[model samples]
Target chain A: MSEAVEIPSGTLTVTRPIGVQFSWRKAIPWLLTGPLLLFMLAFYAVPVVAMLLRSVNDPTWTLAHFHALASDTVFFKVFSNTLYTAFTVTIGALLFGYPLALALVRTPRWAPVILIMILLPFWTSVLVRSYAWMVLMGRHGLINEALLALGTIERPFRILNTPLATQIAMIHILLPYMVLPIANALRQIDPSLPRASSGLGATPWGTFRQITLPLSMSGVAAGMLLVFVLALGFYITPAMLGGPREITLSMLIDLQVDQLNWAYAATLSAVLLATTLAIIGVFYRLPGVSNAFRMGAR
Target chain B: MRRFPSSKHFSRRTAMGLIGAGLAAPYVRPSYAQGAWPEQTSIPDILKGSGELRIATFGGTMQETQVKAYFEPFEKISGIKVRYFPGTSAPKVKAMVETGNVEWDVAQLSRGSIMNLQKQGEYFEKIDYSLIDDGVGKEFRFEYGIEMLVWAQVLAYRTDAFKGAVPKGWADFWDTAKFPGDRALLGTTGGGWPELEFALMAAGVPADKIYPIDIDKAFASYDKIKKSVVKWWDTGAIPIQLLTDREVSMTSVWNGRMAALQAAGVPADISWGQGLSKRDAWGIPKGAKNAANAMKFVAYSTMAIPQARVAWGIPYGSVNIKSNEFIPEARQAVLPSAPAIKSQLVNYDYDWWIENREAVIGRFNKWLLG
Candidate 1:
């Protein structure tokens, strides 16, 4: 209220107090974010910090869990496998999602319909969706049954409980996470830039390549980051859809926790958390990704 | 009828424990034929109490079966109120005891889990054998807990899979050329112990001498069918689902789950030969509020009539040796405890697993992914 003191008429330069204006501007954001910041600190940050501490502190202050991970071939295999799956799923999601997002933005008349189509599956529980994938991709599932009816194959194809199944289901589940951001960015683009480029006698493909694609790179970066980080921690999908050897770090953490090997489980969790942070760091280091994150925050 | 896959097993262990006083639960009529009510054994005076005895059960169908078998009747006959919670396991008990806020008077856990936790610290109250029924076998009794129910992990195959040949044992399950279809086995995905016993038997190791398991020989056996095995199932439902889908023509499944599937006309039959019997036990957490009532209820639940009631409602076998007489022979034939089937099953050594599980799992995971 003090900062809102009105200036005298026709004297626009008559001075509000500079200190009050600066203090209010600085304090508003903090005041607005206070509760959420406290909640995240209490529920998320503290537990995560405690969990990271458990990696070395539990039972005794020891580095055996990390030491074991150094030579653990299964750990290495699973870690690499996790990264491979995340990368594949991100690329897959981008391939499917970017086109859908483009279609969503380009077709204004059908925007709501396309949005609902994307949002419907997004709103469904991941478990239900994963199970739906199981029913679709199982040996005797709908796809195989249809394929058999069409005489496309002599025998039922194995699809479920494989890496292929894991990627497919993860992409399906994460498509919206990729699509919505890209669509938002695409919507934010001024329509005249492409129009002006085309007006200059530039070909449509040339205009799109030179004008539109570069503008949407931020959205693409944002979408890929979201999908990849989410994919890194996926548990139920791979467990339900991937093969026995498709063990991810999340599953390994779960396994160790069940065995009451809290220290090892904490170590695995810390590694996963660290890897996610590293990926985020890498994304930020990429050109335009930091801007994408800033635009995403808006 | 479904069991926990390994990832779910942890949450399943940290089960909710709540006490309800004088709460009336809906009566689920026993699915099996009923014997005389006011069960032949009388409730002792000490067993009749007006207070609540909270029990931690693995809810869903198991809870429903237990309610029909003992919880409802025990509440009615004894003046003691029976309050049932779901999803109890050894870890929950340990958590409760360590925190000094033991919520459950009693919990249902595996003998191995109870012993594993007991070895870590004093989490359970020592079993009072004098209050227990004589029908419970000597083998089922332990210092801290008593095994109350028995189920088996056995080979289950589609009746239509092999045309006329029956896959009688693990050897037949491993003989994919003869069986001629995909197979599923228990994997170490969900903190579930791998079925090393099955692998040993598949390698022609006698059921009697299967443990101290020859891990190398077992893996060698697993190698023969690794390519043919389509799924390494973690939960009880997966194998049944696989069989129903004909995705895998043969799989290792829990006997009770297979029974449910067969009842649903899935055409899957369990081969009890060389199966492994796993037990669920009742453990009273140390410093439980109603420890005395829990003891009395434990004793009451294992009596021949109550034990038979449980077997009648669900396909799980009763630990009470006399329970077989009360259950019809037809029902007994489907249970793991039946003499014909029991003779073939190798009793699982919980002690052996408790000692060697971590090392074995590390080796198993390395081998599996390799």
Candidate 2:
């Protein structure tokens, strides 16, 4: 330093050799990213782009389909109904799922058996499960028959082909999706934190509200996000169980496809995709949400 | 950053191109060979020889029994083997036709599909009038296909529930107060069209005047009965089960299904009065791989003897005049093609329905959703 040695101008500048050395490390990262990039470009991006193009650009590049979607009362009604149903089901699943998940986490010894019970219905085909619910909720179904035997009602209850039936079936089908994640999140939380909080003159309820819940928020959010996204695309359960008045966007899409109106179907699909993305975007913005969700091994 | 040479991309592209080429290679065969169309005489030759002839149908016990009774004997006599593929829906038929890799030579199609396809152009080979028995041909004639079986969509009721006060006809079916409790109807859009048409007729729209049905009026009538309709069954089995289990007091069920329920001692009875009878027909695809064999299969399936055998096993009344001779007089009353039942039954105007099917179904779905 004291000598103030004369430095070569080229040495001060980043040389080609240094650049090459730096790029060599970057090469492996690019190589690793290449397959994923190509996959996303081909499968995900291309299809989504094609769908969007089809929705607005008809044979002559007209927005007739989108206009139809906007102008039509049926479209708006069904779209709204689909969202309303998804939201309600998500809320219902969360309300019911959280308690069950909490219970499962606290359950000692027989937890695996309890977990199996939760997963049992998931093993069956959705179509079969829907049909099973149809029979169970039918006019002269088990519930009605039992009620009649008990002289609770004079007539058979008409529960089949109703929104109530649709919701019940959907909740039963989607409960596992919510439970597994929340349970996993709860199970991973250190018991010592809650114990330490309680030792500091905090009530069990307060400790749960402040510590356990905060820690479990990641799992809860993840489960909610998963269940809500999945609920948006539900077709079979609603179709089989729900009445005509309870028709969803999926049903409308199905009808359009069946009638060979692919353009309209594409439009509906695009709307569903957009709505789902918007939901995910909103979810990502919630405080502590990103970090809370970051804990789990997805 | 250094740009890497995309050898991986090139390899992938090359691999995809090779696969595409391999997939397209089989389709390079000449569209129409000089000897491709089986000579008209091959039908008789195939009938005489011993080989398997595949017959496709909308499969059920009824169709299965018919296949056994009709195709099995034909196989034994002609030494032709028989295979069955259940033709489930119109889309399935379209798929089979467009693919040109037909698994089933002869397929049974609903009258509506037959009319639609016929209007679309010659999907099936035109029948040889000379080969057909005049009496049999006259009875079971269609422009593009031959009638295979006839079944009535009749009012079925639980005898125990209805007692002696059974709903007689379409008018009675619409009357929920008199014949109360829950009702079941078909959930299919196709099924709804015929029901709405029948409802209009029951509301006193005449048979000949049934064309250009008032959609609003039909839906108004449907709305009245909609509340009483506890369930809309999608499959053939559900209506029968609903009646058998006493889940619903009444339902519109196919005659064969009702017969099956009655046979099972479910205390269910069907009314043929003013019943809408659907005629199922046999036809070959437009560019069928085995057109000659398909024709032979169709001809054999529609024959009077086979038709009679089919009628005897299944409740589907045969279109062939000779089938009546095989059926006992007491049992004939239950048959859709019987003189008494046929006299009261409304022969659906297939031409009008076919032309207006899409429009009518669209309106029906809108009404259903509303």
The per-model DockQ list reads 0.36, 0.14
How well does candidate 1 reproduce the true complex, by DockQ?
0.36
Task: Show model 2 residue runs off by greater than 4 Å.
Answer: A1-62, A148-156, A277-298, B1-56, B71-82, B95-104, B117-140, B187-194, B329-331
10 residues in a row with least lDDT, candidate 1 chain B: B16-25
Worst 10-residue lDDT window, candidate 2 chain A = A12-21
Q: Highest lDDT, which number? A: 1
TM-score for each of the candidates? 0.91, 0.79
**Per-residue error (Å), model 2, residue A152:** 4.6
Q: Give the per-residue lDDT digits (tens) of candidate 1, residues A46-142.
A: 9789879989997789898899888889999999999999999999999999989999989999999999999898777665576678789998899
